[model samples]
Target: MRSIWNGAISFGLVSIPVKLINATESHSVSFRQIHTEDGGRIRYRKVCELEDREVGQDEIGKAYEDADGSMIPITDEDLARLPVPTARTIEIVAFVPEERVDPLQMGSAYYLAASGAPAAKPYTLLREALGRSNRVAIAKFALRGRERLGMLRVVGDAIAMHGLLWPDEVRAPEVVAPDAGVTVRDQELDLADALMATLGEIDLDDLHDEYREALEEVVAAKAAGETPPQAPEAAPPGKVLDLMAALENSVRVARESRGGETSGPAEEAEVRTLPRRGASSRWTPKETGGKKSTSTTAKKTTAKKTTAKKTAAKEADGRKATEKKPVAKKPTAKKRAAKSAQPAERSAARSTAEKATGAGKSTGERSTGAGKSTARKTASRKRSA
Candidate 1:
């Protein structure tokens, strides 16, 4: 945090020595010029116009113009020699009611704190005195080598100093003169006050720099490669609104809505979770609700389903592994050799058995042929006799 002006609060003869001021305040907004293509920062150089050349900061000097347009150069020595009397002190010229000072006269506001090691007693004394009086101290102080008239006011427990423009420095309002034909009725004023009353509290937190926030939201959306959601359109005011009637109707509707505990999405969600329900599937809060919390609930459900699907897949794989797995045939030399020899031994035994059976069948066939030949010969001899 930078100090706006480090000057001691001096009352009577007692003086507290401190530094003068800070040039920048946190409330002041700053922007940097950037190259659109590469996002490179843009910088500026000090150039002497007459010489048509860039100049170093050390070569620069302050100057004032004379009546004849001749420049009277002021050196560092001249600036040091000038009577900057109010640099080290807040010389309270007078204490005046804060409301008497127009807000237009007030320009820059800065938080005031004691600088270069705090002097507690003097600071407390000044704060207490200002608070009790309900008045701000109007004073003159040197800042940026120029004398400025300012007001030092107490805000809450702390002091804030504000720079003020002179009376002639303020510009007049440009509003045109009112017409003599026009007049406001008392009824209209009363109705307007009624409408204002309906506006509830003036909480600054409720209202904000909406345009800036919206612009920033757009920028962020674009940066993330997304199209921003469109802002809701504002409703236009009714042409002829009955102020009291509207307020009464609003109050009535609010009361009616709050009275009956409707079957909301929350209740629906609770019902779905009950054990007696036939369906095993989990129900979302939005499903039974007339209003849609569906968008939020759907996202949550989808995430949960995705997680469940992954878990199910893992469980299935585990079950498959636990079930009987097919045994693989061995490709080792010992197993291969044993299999080969077993096949060969079975082939040799079958070959030997076939040879013995073939020999017995051949002998039976020879005997049968001989018996048939003898029977034929005997029958031929009998026929001849």
Candidate 2:
């Protein structure tokens, strides 16, 4: 890497000469403005508003814009005369634990290399000390025409510096959190933890800039006068009506991606369907190769057996009731026939009595008539004698 700045570290009374080399680089694809019709590149020229003409780089100078809309021209000599002590030195202020440095305050990073043979010893001493103490050195240095805060720490066998923003430069995250009224449930948290475990850890070195690579492919295709490859259509996003379901699906997908084996809590967590509701909402943590899990499984098996037995008993009872229904209907039909015969017997007895009474009355009347005739014949015979 090329050195961007040359400076010395001021550690108490000792000074170590070092060179600043960028420790990171950008791999983003850059584009230039162009005329769409003619495919002509467009370039910007610095123009002086007062002269109304384009100006060269040498003719342009730095200026500060004031709140009153006035320009304050600043020259190199004026900046050099300023009372900044960290112009050519990285002055160490204090040594603090690495955790004291907030990540939000960290900015660009650079490596500090020993400038010469004499600097090698001091640089190695500082690196070893930082490594042993597990602390970073807070520092102040001037770069790009301004003084800035930095943190120096040991990186491998060498020392590196990370430019830090001033305390005032970092904004307080007052409104970044969700609404106070929103709350998370324990079940939701459990699933989230499971998902995190399923995802597990990955080596940062395995990652690459995929967007840049795709852009490069498109550019190369266009240059070769061929059709650019099309990206696969992304699945449409669905609204999260159920947070628990979303978390479960995420865990499932993560497990699938890792060949169905997940580390940590995910391995212990099991998803099962609720028998009564017929929905997969229950999360049970099963300990592998443990007596407790075995006992639980045995208990479940026993419960299932009990349920099956109960169901069978109920079915048998139902069948017995169905069989008894026909037997009960037979006696009911016999009772109905006996009740219908009583009215017919009463009617036959009444008709027989009426016929007997009529015959007796006729016989009596004949007897009375015979008696009267006999008396009359006797009286006539007596008169004739």
Candidate 3:
């Protein structure tokens, strides 16, 4: 890309020549009005309001408006004739820590690149000096006949120039009335800190311009001979009461929803901790019904399985009922054979339970010798029987 302006950086007598400024950070969509029937371009022309006559490019002049609404016209030739204000120099006025600058003063940012006949030593010196000092150099220069202000700082091992607005250009902060009724408790502050801690590191690239993407989509729809969809209506704000409580509840809901998205199946499967005894009252009618319905299906499932496996006729009947949505129910033949095998199964199950009990025991003596011997004797007798 071509450089927007030809310029040089100046600190004292040294000039590390560079060219580049006036780059736009954003792009605006432009539409051309056209004739509905003929599809001919509908062009606009400049017309003098007082004379009611068309004005050509030669007649146009830049005008500056005064505080009292008076206009002073300045011609292009006059603007060009004005003496260049340090055209080849970026005269530093002061050096200030970057954080001292208010965010409101920030405008556009541009990369500072060395032009032809690169002054490598001077550029390196400036970059190194700024980094060592931990300060940005504020400077004034002129471009396109308008006096411009800028800040030069070391950004990630490279020099970046950021344009800034004048203090007068920025609107003054308005006074806000204090909410005397509002007071925060230590517990609330602690919770707030915890919530903030959960919000981890900052990643600038993580953000995207959703509005611009939506607008582009709308434009594409129009181009495809479809009407653009209406924008979503804004949601009304909820009533304010117990502001901290509302905020805390909202945060919890958001965390739960987002947690469900990021959590693994194992993490989500964890059982919820129950309330302490006497901490909560018995459920009301509505709550009782809601809780009961959720448990009813689980109880029915268990009952159906028990009734099916325990009896031959019931097992057959249950299999027919479950034909629509199948479940693996134990077979009657397996159950009968399991009865003869029951003693063996019970012995195996007992041995398994004994081993499990031994493994889980805190007392080493009972678990080590006696438990194993007793378990082995019982298992052998059952097997022989």
Name the candidate that leads on TM-score. 2
**TM-scores for candidates 1 onward, in order:** 0.53, 0.68, 0.56
- Cα lDDT of model 2 overall? 0.79
Runs in model 2 lying further than 4 Å from the true structure? 67-70, 264-385
* The 10-residue segment with the lowest total lDDT in model 3: 263-272
Query: For model 2, how does the per-residue alpha-carbon lDDT over 1-385 read when each residue is reduced to its tens digit?
Result: 8999998999998899999999999889899999999989999989889999999988989899999999999998887677876888999999999999999999999999999999999999899999999899999999988999999998889899999999999988877866688889988888898888788889999998899999999999999999999999999997666666677778888898999886645454444333345555355445564436777779999999999999999999798668658544533443343344345433443343334334453474454344344434443544565
> After aligning candidate 3 to the native by TM-score, how far in Å is the CA of 127 from where it should be?
1.8
**Which pairs of residues have clashing backbones in candidate 2?**
none
lDDT (Cα, tens digit) per residue for candidate 1, span 212-257: 6777778789889999969789899754344444544444443345
lDDT, candidate 2, at 152 = 100
Best-to-worst ranking by lDDT: 2, 3, 1
RMSD values, in order shown:
29.1, 17.4, 20.5
Better of 2 and 3 by TM-score: 2
Query: Which residue pairs collide, candidate 3?
Result: none
